[model samples]
Structure formats: C-alpha cells, structure tokens
Target chain A: MIQQKIPGKPVTVTINGKKYRANEGEILLSVAIREKIEIPHLCFEASLDPYGACRLCMVEVVRKGKREMATSCTLRAADGLEVLTDTPEIEKHRSILFELYLAEAPKSDVIRDMAAHYGVTRTRFLKRIEQGDPLGNKCVLCGLCVRACSEIMGAGAINFINRGPYTVVNTPYYAPSRDCFGCGACVRVCPTNAIEMEDVGADRVMKSWSDTRVPLSQCECCGRYYAPRELSASVLARLDTPLKEEIARLCPECRGKQLAQNEILAGRGGRATHG
Target chain B: MDERTLDAIIARHDAPAGRLLGILGEIQNQEGYVPRETLELLSEKLGVRLSQLYGLATFYSYFTLRPVGDHVITVCMGTACHVKGAVAILEALEGLLGIKSDVTDDGKLSVTTIDRKFTVEIARCFGACSMAPVLRIDGNLYGYATPEDLPVILGEYGWTP
Candidate 1:
C-alpha cells in the first residue's frame, strides 16, 4: 500500500525516457514544471485553465508504436504515458515556432532571450511592427492578458479584434473601456509584460487599452491612494460581516494596525464591540 | 432590428447547443450587417458577454460590423484568380471608384466610395476557381473578368464617368 499525498490517484509518466510521478488527469506541463523540466510554455497560468494557445510545449506522445505531437500544457497525465520533449521532430517544430514568435513580437526582450536560448537568432518571416503600437510591440497575441481580465477578473474590458494577418488584441472599437476594474490581474498574468499600466495621480491608467482610467481610493487615515475604488468596493462587498466604516476607509497597512489595536482593546475591556 | 424581431429570431435558435452562430447568421441575413445595438440586446437576452459576441462577429468574414455599400464589388484573391490578373482588375476598380483599397487596423481589406454606392473588397476565394478572376457585384458573379470589362459592368449598375 502506497501513501497518497495528492487528491488524485498517483500515476507514473515517462518524459524523454525518464519516469516521473504525476497525479492522474494532471496537466503534463504542470508535472514537467514541478519536476524542474525545461519545457517552455506561455499562456498557461496555474490559476486559469490550460488553453494551449502558444504551442511552445510540444511533446511527442508515444502510444503503441504511434507517436503524435501534442501540446503538453493541455495533455492530461495518465499511467504509462510516455512523451518526448526534445526529439528532432519536436526541435524542428519548436525552432519554426520560435521564428514565428520572433517575427510576431520583434521588440520583446523575453522572446529574444528565449529564442536565443533555443539557438534561434534570426527569423525568415517578415517582421511586423505596428506604428505607435500600444503594447510596445511585445505582445505575441497569446491571450493571457485577455483571459486573465475576463475569466479571472470578470472585467471583459478587452478582446482580440479582427481576423488572420490583421489580428490584434485591444479594447473594443479601440476605445477606452468603461468595464475595466483596474485590478492589474492582466498585468500580473501577462507572460511578456505586454500590457502597459500606470498609477498617475489618483487614477490607475490602462495605457494600452486606449488609456482607460480607473479612479483610485484614498485611505482616510494616512491619505494614501492605494487600490482602485470600484475593485475595493466590490471586494469589501464580498466580506461576510461588514467592516466598520472607519476601518474600511483605511489602507491595508493602516487597517491592519487599527485591527490589531482594536483586538488588544477588546481583550482588555469587557464589552468593547468590534465590528 | 426591433426588439420583437430580435426576440423572435432568438426564440427560433434558442436551443441548448450552437445557438449563437445561428442567431448571428439570421441577424446578418436580415440586417445586412450585425449592428452594435443588436449585439448588446443579444448579449442581454442570451447572457453572453459583449466582447465574446464582438469577437465572433469579427472572426467570421461573413459578418460585417459596418454597413455595407448598396453594391459590393468582391474580387477573388485566390492563387488561381491572382494568376488570372485579379490584381489588375482590382486596381482598375480602385481607380474607377476613386477609393484606394485600405487595410483596416485589424487587417480587413475594404474601401467604400464617398457616395457609399460601391464598396471594393478582397475575398480569399469564392470557391469558383474554374472561373478564375471572378468578381461579384451585388450577388452577380462576373467570371473571367478583365480590367476592360469593369466599365461596361458598372454601366449595368447605373454608374457613369
């Protein structure tokens, strides 16, 4: 009998002729990352579901003398699953993809560094640099930022507009969005740091999304503008018991101190009512 | 274009699966183009996000967001058509219409005349390669089209000069 640590049934999968343990139905890319395998992947955030948009983590899954190329990010782990991450065929495919990405995001330092690591110094594909590009020409159109904004933050502020050869992601109608929360989930999840955002005097401006501005809430105690007003209001609304008005207006650091002081006073006094 | 008509259309294809595309197609057929208001109404009725609807509309070339001209001149840009001098025919139309073929920021190639009487657009293929260098004007397909034939063709549409 084996001790089970993870929730699912333990399964062993082979990657590049080496056996590794994985939970059943776990994403092969997640398993590879946990084992310190150098399988490069983008558009895969742990919090969000794997969509396999980037096609970087191509692996050859061998089954009964048949080999099929599959994205490891979307491939589920199973018992006796064998995959080759660095075969000649996979290397060739990855090199072409790297070249395409190089052409796609010509100004991306991350893409340049990663492509260089794979010995792809130049691309044969025509380079496209949009004049006055809002994303600084670093975006690979991986849809990570778009997904993070919509799926995670529920903002739905931006999306991919147009079709093949002319495809680009931006706010609808290339206008400043009214639906954005200014939570910065998109910025945090972007693989290439393509989204440009700034805190410019009492407002958080999403510079890439047509300079959409979200108002910042000022802390009553310390006079520091911390988070977006709408985001903070929505978060505060989700709390089980409503916080005191005074404490709610304070920033996180000031609120923490106030809460601690209240806790001490509550312990010392018999009937100190703390909201 | 009204709420009642939109609601009726939605009701027709409001099945459990694959309703959005069907509803959108019907709207495109009836309205010639999918209006923003219709999309907003659909979003509210179907509980779909506006961004997703916009994405679907833009992804398919069949759906046009802007209102199309009274007469649409669609030139086939397929390999077969290109080999048959489609570029020359297209350039001739541009000169005749006084509208340069401009690619939008999102990469769609379309140009409408100032009068909005004619719109010149490029299609990947109309799937009629046998009749290479095909151009369709308002559902009338002109096969084996040459730059010389454009003036005579526009005459049929009541265009002068």
Candidate 2:
C-alpha cells in the first residue's frame, strides 16, 4: 500500500520496490489505481466497500519476512508491507483471470480493453460464455449496481437472486417490478450497459436483460425524461420551499439558464431580481 | 457521543448553516478522528448533506477519519530534499521504527503508526532547500539528517534502542 496523503502522521509501505507513505487501513489497490499503477479491477470503487470479487487486483505482499499473495483491494496499507504489483508471476496469475473474463464475454469491451492493457491478446481457454442481458451485456456481476441502488440511491429496487454461476440480478420474483420507481439508479451504476434506459412518452423505462422495465419521469421544461416521477416530485417539492416554485418546473439546463441570467443581471446591475 | 454533547458542540458554532469546518475541527480536536456516526449525527442536526460533509472532511488534510499518533514525524521528499538523500534518511527512519511509506495508497500527507504512538509523514519541501533532507519530529526541525542520525535522535525521544 502506498501512502500519498501527508497529513498528521504518514505510514510508509513499499510498492514495486519504491517506498511510499499512505494512510492506515486504505485499500492497496486504491493506492495503485490512483497512481495509475495498472492494477486491473472491476469491483473496486472508492465510495463503496472494498469488495474483492474481481480477483484482478492481486499483488505479492512481503511483510515482516512473510510472503503471500493478497487481493490489493482488501489489503490494508500497513507500515513495512512491501507490495509487488507487476511481476512475471503476478502477471501470469492475473492473465489467467483476465483470460477467463474474456472467455465469459468475448465481445465485452471491459475484458477486452483491460486484457489489451495487460497485453493478454488471446485466451486459449474455451469460451463457456453464459447468456446475459441484451446488448451483449458482458456484466461481470461486480455488484456495484446492486450496492449503489441500495446504498447510494437508497432504492432497493434491483438485487441479485439465486446462487453460484446461475445467479442473475433482478427485481424480486423476476416480475415487471411494481416496486421499482423507474429511477434508473441501477442503470446509472451498471458497469455494463446490461441495464438500459429508453423514453416512452411521459415515462422513461430502464430495461435489463431479465426483461424488467422501470418507468421514470420526463423533464417538464425540455420535454425530456430525467428521473422517476416520484423522485422528481420529491426533489422539486424540496426545492420549492427554499427556491422558486418556477425553478422546480424547469429542468436542470433551464434552471442553469435562470441562474446564469440572474448572474448576468447581478453583474450588470446591483441587487438584480429575476421578477 | 451523546446527542446533548453534539447539540452543545453545534451550539458553539454561530449557526448550523455553514459552520461545517468549525464543527469538524471541534470534533477532530475532541475525538482523534471524525467518526462516521458523528458525521451522520451532524447531518441530521445541521441539515447538511452527508456527501457534502464528507467532501469537506476528506478534502482537508487536517481532517482524518482515522486516529493519528501523539508524535508526528515529517520528512521532506521534495526535489531538493531528494537530491540531499531524503529517501535514504526516510528509509533509515523506516528501518528504525519499522513504519513503511504508503504514499501510493491514500494520496494523504501522513500515515500514523500502528500503535498510534507516531505518525510518519512527508512533505514536498519546507521551502528550505539549503537545509535539504529535513524532517520534523514533534514540530522540531532536523536539517541535513542522515541515516546515521536516526537511532540517536530517536533515543532522545525515548525510542527503545
């Protein structure tokens, strides 16, 4: 783990033979990722918990005379821990995983791009490509979408059902989802375009490979759909109290225009009011 | 902390609208690091978004989510310091205390010791090129420090030989 922050006390850890100070308990992959260290991972997000499901961020850790290979995302940047990110052995192990990922989604840009980055031109392993959501989904199931919906958006609209390789993300009971707000929060967080959104009149439907559709709201001002009706209404209702009710009816761009107009007026004249 | 204490802490600030920095400083000063629970408490009490509060907390180097040690050890690794053997001096200190550098990890300025006794930190430069290879131990500046100067200096701070 590398320590970049120079705050109160800095702990030092070695990465690729160079000593770097890092914060205690920070994920090692984040250290490497931030420095453009080229540790391939799909399940890693700074905002979310360090889920080591990707298995791509493995690094050789030499700490206090013990050598072990550990997932960099789960590993803490403790002092005296020496991490070797790119070695022949580490790369060999990583290439196997990358190769497997490619076989899973040969058309997947995620695996293909990363494999290209790591120089994995081809995979000898036979493609046991399992079927996934439409648009050649290529969803590696990093769980970022599932976590984001429940955590960030506070909407437990979509989730993973079943176990093992048969597991797929879906709303409860694989139904059309009456509970879904059409927020498309899951779609926004999806690693792959497996979850897609389309506008149909006043409603915008977020579609997944499971054939589930979530309806959303169309922007009133621009006649463009932005969010689910419930979410939009809630946000507008909140803004109305402290802000102008007219601003609530307008979309973000219009609101920006209104603010910009106010700014220009204020700049041109003193105490300018839109009304 | 209890809600009453948190309420009093909020009361110390002029208002609940924009005293986030002041409130964070006060909380950090009182409790070694800002607790997430405290942040949630502040969010509820102050009506500030949790995300906004987190932005401020992580942006400022002074604010730490983790507890730091009593003594702060700062080494200069700026271009001038590097030419002056700052890396060697830092390595020597690391060898002495067994604290490694994690600069590649958090992009933070410092990393505290595991025992929480010391925080081994680094800075680019103190604007003192002449005094290259400088490091500070508990606010006291040591210029032109060599690998040989470590154990003896650390001994002065009651570091066991």
Candidate 3:
C-alpha cells in the first residue's frame, strides 16, 4: 500500500516553465523559494506568515488565456497553477518598487545592493532621511519586526503607532517597553536589520524601542551574562520537566558539557558533580 | 472613570456585544477620553494587547487618551466652514483658554486648557454647511459662529472667568 508522507495532495506547479512538486494550499512564494527560482521578496519570513506589504514578489498567474498579477507570498499553490516569475509587467512593477524602497530607506546598504542587483540604482522620488533616527533610517516599515515580536515572542511590546503617512512601529507612548522579553526575535526577523539590540553589562538594551532595558541572566558556571532572565525563564517553563537546579543556571554551551559529563558518569554508575 | 466602573463597563460589554470598538466607545462616552490605566485594565480583562488597544484609540478621532476638559469646544474646519473664518474662531478659543494649540508627538488633535476647564478642537465638518463657521460646545451647535460670539457662548457653559 502506497502512503503519502506529506499532508495536502501532491500538486505540481509550473514556475518559469519548470514544474516543481508541492503540496496543495502551500504558499506559492514558499514553493518558488524552495525550487531556487529567482523571485525577490522582503517581508516574507518562514517563521511568520506572509504579510505581502513589500509587494516585491509580484508574479503573473496565467489561467486559460487571461493573466492576473498577485503577490506570490499570499498566493496559494494548486494543480496546474502556471505562473511567470519575471514577466515584463512584473519587471516594471519591481523597478518602481525598488525606487520607492530606495527613497524610503536610503541608508540601507542591503536595499542599495539588492536594488543594484535588479538594475535600479536611482530614484526620482524625494529621499526621506530623518535626523538621528534610532533605526538608522533603514526601516522600510514592513511590519516584520512588529509582527515577529507580537506573534512569535508573544511580547506585543511594539506596534504600528499613529496613522497614515505618520505611521511608525514603536513601543506605546514611545516609552520604554515594560513587556519586551529581550528575546531578539525581532532583530532576527527584521528583513532590513532595522531593529537594534545590544547587551550592555547586566541589561539588554533595545535601543530602537526608546532604550528599553531587560535584565540578563548570569551563568552559574561561567558567571557570564548570557540571555535575558525573563526569556530564559519562559523557555525553561515550556519544558515538560524542569531542569536540575545546577544545570538550569548554566549557559547553553556549559549546559551541554554538563549534560554530556552526566551521561558518561551515569553509564559508569557514578554520581556526577556539578562543574 | 474609576477601576470599578471600568470593570462594570467591561462586564456589561463582555457578553453579547463584546466588541473592542463598542467597549472603547462606551468608555469614551462616559469618561470623555480613554485613560491609560483604564486601557491597561481593559487589556488584562479582555485578553487583548495594550498596543492593539492603543492603536485603536489613536486611529479613531472620536477616542482621546488624555483627560478632556469639562467643556469641549469643537470648531469645524470643513471647506465651507474654513471659508467663513473658522480659523479665527479656533484662534479666539485658544486665546480665551490662554493656551497655544500644540500638536503632541502622538498626533492627538484636541488641546485642553491648563486648569482643565475647557478643551478646544477642530472637526472636519458637522455636515451643516448652511451654518458655515459652525462651533459646538458640549454638543450644542452654534450656527454661523464668529470669534466675537465665543466668550458669550462659553459663558453659557459656566466659563464666566
């Protein structure tokens, strides 16, 4: 008896005339990205859901004799879902989008390099450069950091404040966020590396969010401050069984060494001493 | 509103009409503005994020986060009203309140007096173009209002000083 290992009926999607196997209802952008197809995207994070705010991955879907443009990140895969990644219309759209991004985040080398890759080096739009911007004037306002913090970390520390043209992502009242776990999920998920975080002494300073400081946990063995205390505590709480008292206070590297030592000692039928 | 009153309001809205907007609207109507403490309490009680509530409060012009004055003076700044010296009326109210119109960092619209006696604001329109340069104080409309009519109209609302 043949069994399907993956969920969703296997469907082949044609991208740039090459057919690739994917599950039905899977994101088209995910399929294109997995198959090494050249589709430029910014706001798509594998951990978080597709937001489609960047509009960089616009692809043309052909059905019968008609064509429709849609964001590949939000587009779902189905059988015979023929799509062109770099059609003339998509190129024109990408060129204008790159120009807009260039103007929006002029200080970002990531944007400049990516734009130059697609042959868009100049923009006619007025450049926006705020003096002493905490995000280093590189934020494209893609909401990836905001969404990652709230959705992934359950922090909900930052969000889109104000409205319309004045909209910006930051802590409430632009004050130091009391709820930030200092998990660095936002810094990791930021497509343009707009979020700034640094561990200063005993506290992790979220410089972008009004210098929000979260306390760092000191390792028992190394006596070095490693992770945020709250974040470590939260992660420990999720385990089925709590770690041993001595092992819980050590950092990841030290903890791994201690666990391996304990395994060898247990095999030798001897009690292991806490290093 | 006190914490108890806020709890009661949330309890009342918690059942059939537990929508966040409706609950916030009720708070605005009762308290003139949604207080930060009240929003925090609402976030905890309703299991909604504080940022989400703050976003909603700031997005809508009807909801204000700061404490408003006892008497709210709203001058319409619609196209018809602006043509008829609406700016003059707003300036007059600012002068009467002894406070300059300052836009805060959060983009809040209304400006309240220092003593918290009065708040002057601008509205897009009241849809009463026949009464161009219209002003409303405590929900009472003054049609065809002038800068000169402010002191007298405010006097009626216990602004004798």
Could you say which candidate leads in lDDT? 1
lDDT of 2 by residue, B30-135 (tens): 8867887897789778775454565467656667776678777888889999998998987887887877877522356566667777778888778878888898
Kindly list the per-residue Cα lDDT of model 3 for residues A157-224, writing each as its tens digit. Answer: 98888777567788877788888999998899888888899999999999998899999999988888
RMSD of each: 3.6, 22.2, 3.9
What value does the interface RMSD of model 1 take? 1.4
Give the Å shift of residue A272 in candidate 2: 3.6
Q: Global CA lDDT of candidate 3, please? A: 0.86
| Whole-model lDDT values for every prediction | 0.88, 0.72, 0.86
Task: Give the per-residue Cα lDDT of candidate 1 at A100.
Answer: 96
Q: What lDDT score is found at residue A163 in candidate 1?
A: 78
Q: What TM-score does model 3 score on chain A?
A: 0.92
For candidate 1, the per-residue lDDT at B159 reads: 81
Top model number, DockQ: 1
lDDT of 1 at B64: 84
DockQ, prediction 1: 0.69
* Cα lDDT tens digits for candidate 1, A30-124: 89999999998878888888889999999999999899999998899999999999999999999999999999999999999999999999999
Listed in order, each prediction's TM-score against the native is 0.89, 0.56, 0.87
Q: Which pairs of residues collide in model 3?
A: none
Model 1: per-residue Cα lDDT over B1-161, one tens digit each: 99999999998995877788999999999987899889888988998777778888888988888887788889999999999999999999999989889777656788888998988889999999999999999899999999999999999987898
**Candidate 2 i-RMS (Å)?**
14.7
For model 3 the TM-score comes to 0.87
